[model samples]
Target: METMRAQELHSFYGKSPVIQGVSFDLEPGEFLALLGRNGVGKTTLLKSLMGLTDGCTGGLVFGESNLLSLSTSQRAKLGIAYIPQGREIIPGFTVRENILMGTFARVDGRREIPEYLFEMFPILREFIGRKGGDLSGGQQQQLAIARALAMDPKILILDEPTEGIQPNIVKQIEEAIIRLNRERGLGIILVEQNVPFARRACDRFMVLDKGRVVVSGHSKDLTDSVVEKHLTF
Candidate 1:
């Protein structure tokens, strides 16, 4: 597969296991919602797939390559872009500078944001001169995603994008995700606690209960009871 797949992925922080035999496959152009409560291994699974975990076991394969042996940069080079929780934008750099940082994997080091990027995110053009720290929370979230998009990744992993954003901006972000999946053929793995948002944005979803996949199927198959049981505290 040209997209991400995990077979019995397991990881731990110290002796306590976080991801316990978790497995899923993301198809090209598919939007997969990863739903779980706090500390359920959602972020840990993402890190493992991106090779950020120090002691991951089992198989995390991306496009025929086992990612356990690869470095984070190497995984990024293979086109897995992660926009972590809290929108990790560089506070000191200009918006353009932050976006430019995504080009580290590029063979040609270009400082300029490609014109094509503006087509995906026109608001970025207006913020080029603004410092990343000065942007509104919503705008900073957009910048974080745009920065990841600049990597031109085959797969985009977004962690709780709507967690702290305004509702209007969340709508826009959702639209952008739809465009990426439908028009651009980009596979998206989104980690979100918002059930409605997840159902709207993803075609398929997997629910994690204490680091185990408890419910998984097409999003169309989900019900209120399922969400309440698996996701609610």
Candidate 2:
């Protein structure tokens, strides 16, 4: 298990800072929850990690490689998968088609969706022919994650995975995250505002306030007072 570090990260849009000097480390197979209120730069930080934004300073390093210089596809090829907010499934594509898109980064010219994806999200197998737009919101979220899993990523950045999802489906996704970390040894950076669920699923968490990391600690060490001041909106 190697260390994953985001070192002194800073980013801005149109001369206004969005992520202000954030730093964090993720141990391999660790589950970290990124907790913050809306528009506090959580998504912007995730996008910066993918190198989609123009002016992200500092570094996102995976082992020995610096991610800041890599293009989105290059980062994807290096095993960084981002499932951004809104699920973002192609509405016109079938479930199978959408999931297969995750394989676009493969270098060996593989044309098929990897076999491990079906094992991770069995429900996707059932919905193979179904249109992604026709699925329930929870189902769409599942497909989005399954699509990311197909990329064989070392680190998965999931933004607001439980937003607008039913409770039962949320539980399923949580359990799946636990299994992935425990069994496959994948690192997860979960961007979520759902405090209770995030605390339950992640080993550690960081609080982002006004584009900066205000506090961070293990989930078990996060007290009620800490939650009220930083997590409550």
Candidate 3:
């Protein structure tokens, strides 16, 4: 079975080590929700997984292959797609052009947008000719997700995907995420503060506090006490 494991992992930004001694394992098609309070290392941990950090120590393995040794682009080529918090769509590019950018990492170099992407987020299709910067926040978030899907990645990591979106669009994004995991069998690592959504959609959950994983278990095992202790401010 496919697996991604981090052993005693530490990630640094310049002289500052933001993530220390973090460890976890994600099997194929697993959805792991990463929960944490503000200033914790949740974002950095995701960056480390994608080799976006300044440097990292220890081991990161995906199946039989080692990932820490790979570069950011190399990691993306290995079927790991990261949709960052800021929805980094190119401002000057059209909506279609932004989504097509993800295909650059495809191992087979395929450029076609997956039909399911449009099915999942129809607004992207409707605004295909519009510039990405002109779209609303909800639409940009959807566009970001659609861009990542265009790569046909095996592991999808999203950071606060619904942070600022409207309620209706949040529901749509949530449904899309669940469908991707249930129907497509993609392993997902979601960094989110929405406990209700995380509990409902994830198979397992992990808590990061001050850089280390303080708690982790099946999503069902994540109770109110766990949230109050580690997740709540």
Candidate 4:
């Protein structure tokens, strides 16, 4: 188990500041829901956590290491895997190849894709020979997660895992995310737009607006009134 903490963090895209004065913590095996309206810096905040932003400041620490000081690959080697919003599966690559790509982050040089990933999403094993681009949006999302899990990451940073997915498949993805956190004991930082689902699945929730965390509390505190004010369009 590993813990992630970010304090007074700021991130930029070229000259524009996207994340300002953001701070959070993810204890081992905890689930956090990062929520906000559209155009907020939620995506940028997730990217900052992964060192994918143009630049970042303040402290991002995991255990005793300062993540802000490390390169993206260096962070990955330390067991932080990012599943970005678009899924980002290599189009022409076979499902097996796509999953194997995550193994490069393993410092021990282990190349085996975990059998549990196949159990989580059996479609991945059935379509192991299929090209990544040939799968549906939901299947591709599951494959994206499989690719990340192949690295044996300690913390999973997910950016809108359910965006643009079909309704039925969305439930499956939600269940899988919850199972990954509760059963597998993986720390989760999820960016989600589904209010009820977020409340149901997350242990705690934070609401980000204009790059700053404006309202945050335990999942039980994320009432409908709070959602109406911060999350509604």
lDDT of each: 0.85, 0.85, 0.93, 0.92
Whichever of 1 and 2 has more TM-score, that candidate is: 1
TM-score ranking, high to low: 3, 4, 1, 2
Cα TM-score per model: 0.94, 0.93, 0.98, 0.97
Taking the tens digit of each residue's C-alpha lDDT, what string does model 3 give over 183-224? 999999999999999999999999998999999999898899
Q: For candidate 4, lDDT tens digit of each residue in 190-231?
A: 999988999998989999999999999999999999998999
Q: Rank the candidates by lDDT, best first.
A: 3, 4, 2, 1
Residue pairs of candidate 1 with colliding backbone atoms: none
Query: Which is better, 3 or 4, measured by TM-score?
Result: 3
In order, how many clashes per candidate?
0, 0, 0, 0
**Which stretches of model 2 miss by more than 4 angstroms?**
114-116
lDDT of 1 by residue, 1-233 (tens): 38678888888777778889998989888899998889888998888788776577888888888888789998888888999988889989998999999887654555556676677667778888889999888889989988888777889999888788888788888888889888888999999887887888799999887888999999887789988788778
Summarize candidate 2's per-residue lDDT along 55-165 as a digit string, tens digits: 888878888888887789998888888988898999999999998898776665666876766776778888899999999999999899888887778888998888889
**lDDT winner, 1 or 3:** 3
Whose lDDT is greatest here? 3
Candidate 2 clashing pairs, residues 3+ apart or interchain? none
